[model samples]
Target: MLSWVVTFLIIALIAGVLGFGGIAGASVEIAKAIFFIAVILFLVSAVVGLVRGRSNI
Candidate 1:
């Protein structure tokens, strides 16, 4: 999932360089959304792990 953010970022950069304003803007927005979702999922997983008494967490 995090890799998707990197992929979108690369696409945005390339699109911007190639003068594709709309594609670049949309890719950037998608990347930002994916990043936030990944962070939220990580936090939720950590909390769940802790609640389950997992020392590795």
Candidate 2:
């Protein structure tokens, strides 16, 4: 998921350099959304793991 966000970011940069304003904007937005989603999922998983570990003790 994080890799995808990075991929899109690179694509956006390239597109912007190539003078594709619309494509670059859309790609950037997509990258941002994916990055946030990945971060949220990571946090949720970490919390779940910590809670489960405590319960096991």
Candidate 3:
């Protein structure tokens, strides 16, 4: 999921450099959304791990 954010960010950068405003804007929005989702998932997983007392983590 984080990888997807990175991929979209790279696409946004490339599109912006090529002057494709619409694609760049859409990619940036997608990247932001994916990044937030990844962060939320990570936080939820961490909370779950701590609550369950997973030593491996």
Which candidate number would show the highest lDDT if scored against the true structure?
1
Local accuracy of candidate 2 as per-residue lDDT tens digits, 1-57: 989999999999999999999999999999999999999999999999988786534
| Better-scoring candidate (lDDT), 1 or 2 | 1
Ranking by lDDT: 1, 2, 3
Residue pairs with colliding backbones in model 1 are none
TM-score of each: 0.91, 0.90, 0.88
Question: Residue-pair clashes per candidate, as listed?
Answer: 0, 0, 0
Q: Tally clashes: model 2.
A: 0
How well does candidate 2 score on lDDT at residue 28?
100
lDDT of 3 by residue, 1-57 (tens): 888999999999999999999999999999999999889999999999889894755
Clash-forming residue pairs, model 3: none
Top TM-score prediction, candidate number: 1
lDDT of 1 by residue, 1-57 (tens): 999999999999999999999999999999999999999999999999889884655
Badly placed stretches (over 4 Å) of model 1 are: 55-57
